[model samples]
Target: MMKYHPLPAFLSACAVSACLFGGHAQAASWKAFSAEGGQAPAPLVLPDLAGRDVDLSAFKGEVVLVNFWATWCEPCREEMPSLQRLQQKLGGRGLRVLAVNVGEGVPRIKQFLERTPVSLTMLRDADSDVMKAWRVRMLPASFLVDRHGMLRYQIVGEADYDDPAQQAPVLELLK
Candidate 1:
């Protein structure tokens, strides 16, 4: 058997490691979108619970956290309380958390929210227009919009909204 040189062995290991890690990094990169310094993303307009037009543009000067969720998603349900805690902790400081319920009727949402003890400003995306416009492929997707209406961070799964470390980004922009 031919002996492999230590240099070649190290190089081979490095190459394989790069390839494996690169794919995972690439996938994670796509999971979130960066704002590139407060640049407004593609515009969207959706209605709130009262059926009034709540245009995304209207929240220009506020740090907005838009969460695309559903009553059926367990993770979404799990994170709602955290989000509510986050909102209550920070809502007074120019933070707007819009919990957009995807393709659900008001009665169902109302019934659900009435029992659950989370206090997020809920919006009904019953027609799914907002969901489609935002290209929301997964449930419990979240986007942090800066005060200037730029799409900053996009988290594609359930997250701890109340965690001080996780909420650091939101807090930084709020200041």
Candidate 2:
């Protein structure tokens, strides 16, 4: 007979609750990265859909929004179009949005793109190494890096990038 462990299941439920409720409350706000005791992020280099290497360091002089997401995540899907719009509205102002897809293949990501088009730079973390390196524990996680490449603000749930309140932090970093 197999033994059942309640501890693991309880912990799993707690994690899910945290992701669904704890983070959801902050969706409309940006949390200062430094307040979380976060420092400059580690180096990141991943391949785009075309397999070309995209390095985070390359965008040092510009504000970069690094978002970790997966196609199956509902919140991730909901916020994608807003992210694209944000890029379009601010790309000329030195704001770059890097949507990092976690642990998904090219075919799946391509399919998602076909259904919901987005022009933001789509990077792949096939092995989830970059995701782990960035300590992303939940879907739709975002971190804003300033022009000097310092981590600024972050949010762990869906955010309407089109919202001026949400864009405030990005604009501040750009300045």
Per-candidate Cα lDDT values, in order, are 0.71, 0.82
Give the top-scoring candidate (lDDT): 2
> Candidate 1 residues 1-175, lDDT tens each?
2233233332334334434442223332213353347445666676777788777778878998888877755567777888888888888999989899877667667767877877777888776677777777666678888887788777766677756666878888799
Q: How much lDDT does candidate 2 score? A: 0.82
- Candidate 1 ranges with C-alpha deviation above 4 Å: 1-35
Q: Write the per-residue lDDT of candidate 2 for residues 1-175, one digit (tens) a residue.
A: 2234233332344347546764456654688964443478888999999999999999989999999887766778889999999999999999999999877779888888999999999999887788778877767789998888888888877889888999999898777
Q: Which ten residues in a row have the lowest lDDT in candidate 1?
A: 22-31
RMSD of each: 14.0, 5.9
